[model samples]
Target chain A: MAYALMIHPTDNVAVVTEAVRPGEDVLYEDANGGQVCLKAAGDVPVYHKIALRDIAPGEQVLKYGKTIGVATAPIAKGEHVHCHNIESPERKELI
Target chain B: MEFYGYRRSDGRVGIRNHVLILPASICASDTAEMIARQVNGAVSFHNQVGCSQVPSDMQYALDMMAGLAANPNVYGTIVVAAGCETCQCGMVMDAIAARTNKPLHGLIIQKEGGTIRLIEKAVRLAREMAAEASTLRREKFPVSELILGTECGGSDPTSGIAANPVIGKVSDALVADGGTVILSETTEFIGAESILADRAKDEHVRRRILEIVERYEQHFIRNGENVRLGNPTPGNKEGGLSTLEEKSLGCIHKGGESVIQAVYDYAKPIPTDVKGLVIMDTPGNDASSIAGMLAGGAQIVVFSSGRGTPLGSPIAPVIKITGNDATFRMMEDNIDFNAAPVITEQKKPAQLGEALYKMVLDCCDGKLSKAEALGFTETAVMRACNYV
Candidate 1:
């Protein structure tokens, strides 16, 4: 069974369907149905996002195929995506 | 395409037949509650807003009281009032009379001489109403007769991912079949107004969606408060949600993909012809939100939660659902159905939706939900708490 879910082809991140340990490999098919392998950078909790590839600091993060927030620091592929290293610029302004 | 329900004199269908003991003001709530308690087949809610409010807010309370009395779910009603309350019992009775031909009786404590005399009179009226309400029988109604209320509270990540999406699937089906769905909790719409605006059926609807959000924001600004300060609530944060917008996005998922037909004010019934999703301006408080939706004539409510809640309505039957599998196991008595399978088993939303609709039909056919079985009815009216 897939340990992560790629909601859409445009999404650069996938939500961990279950908890993952560091160094575990999860397989996913890309937009074109091409298989892509991702290595877990650290222990990621369930329902949290995992970077599918390298992301630069200050870049936007997409979830539900929409911009959920921007990264606060450089995030390597397979690392856990959460409030610690990202800030929701648009959502914060709404508050 | 049809479910069993009670047909009312007003040409409305109801899932439950209840004799309501309604209070016209806070002071009368105790008397109303006692009257309900003394009579079988009667119900009452804790009235929080009856007096001590700006004229406009008082009108909101009266509207809700009247609407509650006229709700299709109610077979009849007995309204009690503390004579001096600004929102008079007569006004509430008149409002309800304008809407329905149901059996109704109104009483005032001061006019009756004392609390003891009022309670005896209220109990007698409630007993008579309850006896009459008990004679009603369920009848089959077409799918178009249903007005669904969708709500979320104590949200967690799973709310957006599983529970809300499951409700969305149900929403889409009901709307496709020509039924009505009322999407509530305007405060939770913050940071997500544009998303909802994009789904409006017309330019007027789109602007109305935007206008209501702006009006709610103004309420906060006028009070020098930021709604964001309370969002992504402590329970939400503990459940893995990181931002208010994140919460809002997940919250709106319950609307499914239907185009919003129109925006409505609190407690006003939807036009019977408008067959799609509709938004009602209501506070995010679970009980009061349910009250607004019920007052608007929804026969049933499908409330979803991730952190879990036992909130129910005094009139409408609330089918409580949860996406948090852990919470489901933990709060087994409070949650009615589990949508956690959507996340755990990767179950399709449509599958869960079908199960939920079946459950809803069963509920309409007289099956009690966990909340209903536990007698967990609760309700209140919305009031602006901006320190004026």
Candidate 2:
């Protein structure tokens, strides 16, 4: 089993440190030793994002324990998060 | 680990051994270049500054010239001047003397009579300096003596995820080993000022960080441009970065998690003992920023790019690293390190960071970087007023 890892618990997503192919078991351990297992949705590349929790519109997306952007729509856990679902506050016009 | 470096009489270690011909004004650049052309192991930048209106600007030019001469990389320097510029040869020579007691000679164009005479005198002086410089031998120096500058340019979406953070990790590793790291480019720190400020050692340092950001914004205001009128640049937009804040957030990662120690003006020498990370107040122009860092005593630079750039400095070695796989593939010759594995494949930032650290060691140990191998020796000093 392979899994993306988060540097900080406050992070909204875990970075795919290794390529996770579809159907591969992905295990995530929370702060309290709680574990969650999910199958990889696809072959996610390194440094790419994998959602840890469902995010709603206008929600601040956290990465590296800091706000990277605000979510523009609801995103499911394990979904790839990027420019498609989030927008920089400075250039909201682009969104 | 140690690298073979030229140990200056002033106790500073230099990675490169060269004789420098420094022009005190724009009028003397050609003469200096000609002199450098006549002598082997001599290098000079075609600078367009030094003769300026404002006293402060003149001081900046003088300081930059003096700093370059005093840099550990140069064994000796020959300053060439027109004798009428605001930054006179005497003044430049005095500044260099104040900093280091390295071998220095001066040639004044007007005092030497004419262009031909000036070139001849400069070449003779440069030849002598080059010969003297060539005698100095490399000695072993600890990695802690290294002052590394970190910068990002031509950034794309992958920069934040891969290259920047990887450099950040390298920064942290260097700092942990007691080496100094300079994180610069004031404009890139605009939106992320508060985040960086929070990492400052104290409230005073935190306030200073904010002040520097405000000062940069004031520059745009004085120029009649909106402060937030979009600053990710056209290249950044083309590479998938949309906004200044987003770019800023990515840029701050280069500082790593180290405490912000001090802030300095353009081309000002950083405090040698100040360990961990410090920020130099410099423009977003890659060449100008790198010049400032080099002037501040950085012996090497780690430049990250998502869109890729082949920029290098004349004095210090610039190691180009990229995050975007496409850009890395497209500009293979320019980039020295492929940080793209952290994005396209599955390398961890720390893993890549360790690799970069090893590369730094290799670079320090006389391994020729792509920039060095390409013979790229670009140099620029930030000037206040625009050149016509």
Candidate 3:
């Protein structure tokens, strides 16, 4: 298994163990025991995250079972999830 | 449940025994260091902050100086003053006396006549103190007596993935054993403040946690700077942390799942009765945040890192743990624990936590850590703002 970890059951992202080249097979068993296998759509570098499922723009991106950010653009399964595609709303504003 | 350490006169326990040469201001710091170098078993850290400052900054300086003096790691303290600084020799000594009854001595350069006389007198005193400190022997003390400080710097994805969560487990274990853990760096709580507040035992503590996070945010906004710009850090950004929220989400895992009991100002000593997790409002700078916890009474510090930094304290043993196996192998001399196996499923968080807890005990019992073996001891007093 060119494996990745789904940290929290609520997370929609999986952090890859090593760099995954485009079109390579990747498997994920999410927190709810949801099994997923897909061909990588983009190069996912080591320690970087990938979408476990399709996410709509403005949807919350979950990691560590918490809201790490909101997606800036529509994200597909196996696509790389990075700063360019997400925004941290809470971190950007202060009361 | 117990480890060998030096039992202080004030009923506190210490993992190391040294005679500390404490400089009252930046001016006297060099002199203080010289004195420490001349005496074996003596250590000193220079004060880099300008002595003359506004009230709040002065308060931080005084409190941190006193905290370093009162730290259980020191067998005695010799406060050296440049004679005309805002923090006077006698006043600093009195402040330290209020906290710990361990041996303390005061010196003034002007009173002693000149640099030659001051250095001579300081060295003589330091040598005597070191000799006295050497005569002390380590005694076994219950682990419950421990006050732990937790911090992170140069964070990355593995910070949340393995390093910090592993520490969170250690925090829970320590708290379960009736010890105290100080979770710090107020800036890191920007996005995850509410999640942390939920872990507070009561509304009061929760409110204070939120309040400090706001205060830090506002402090930046008032100064016309975005807190996000410097946070998450360049190394953090490169290592897959996208934003401050993502970094903070990982950052807070150091506190584990224990309920926060109280919130404290930077450098204020934590009350002995509070045995669970506590938050000390501190800056994001690695050394400054750690210093705040040290002054607040953390006998040992477990610093989680991903990109890796070599920050150590003269008064506390900093055990650096990392989940980035590459960083660990690259900086093995600075890092003490490699928790990367958690991400690989080779080791469970609880198992690594137990192993780390044992390392903590062994460190307390005089197992020299990587930082200590390399003789890396650094400290800095965190100021609320720049000097006026």
Largest lDDT belongs to which candidate? 3
RMSD of 2: 5.0
lDDT (tens digit, per residue) of candidate 3 on A65-86: 8788899999998899988898
In angstroms, the error of model 2 at A32 is 13
Give me the runs in candidate 1 sitting further than 4 Å from their true place: A21-37, A54-57, A91-95, B386-388
TM-score of model number 2: 0.84
- lDDT scores for all predictions? 0.84, 0.81, 0.87
Cα lDDT, model 3, residue B190: 81
Off by over 4 Å in 2: A1-95, B227-230, B386-388
Best by TM-score: 3
lDDT digits (tens) for residues A1-95 of candidate 2: 77665656787777665567766776766656677776666655545667788889899887657676788889777776666777665422110
Span of ten consecutive residues with least summed lDDT in model 3 chain B: B46-55
DockQ of 2: 0.13
Between which residue pairs do clashes occur in model 2?
Answer: none
User: Where does candidate 2 chain A have its weakest 10-residue lDDT segment?
Assistant: A86-95
Candidate 2: tens digits of C-alpha lDDT, residues B145-200: 89999999898767887899999999999999888999999888876788899899
Write model 3 residue lDDT over B234-320, tens digit each, in one string: 888788888788889889999999889999999998877778889999998888888888888788999999999888987789999
**TM-score of every prediction relative to native:** 0.93, 0.84, 0.96
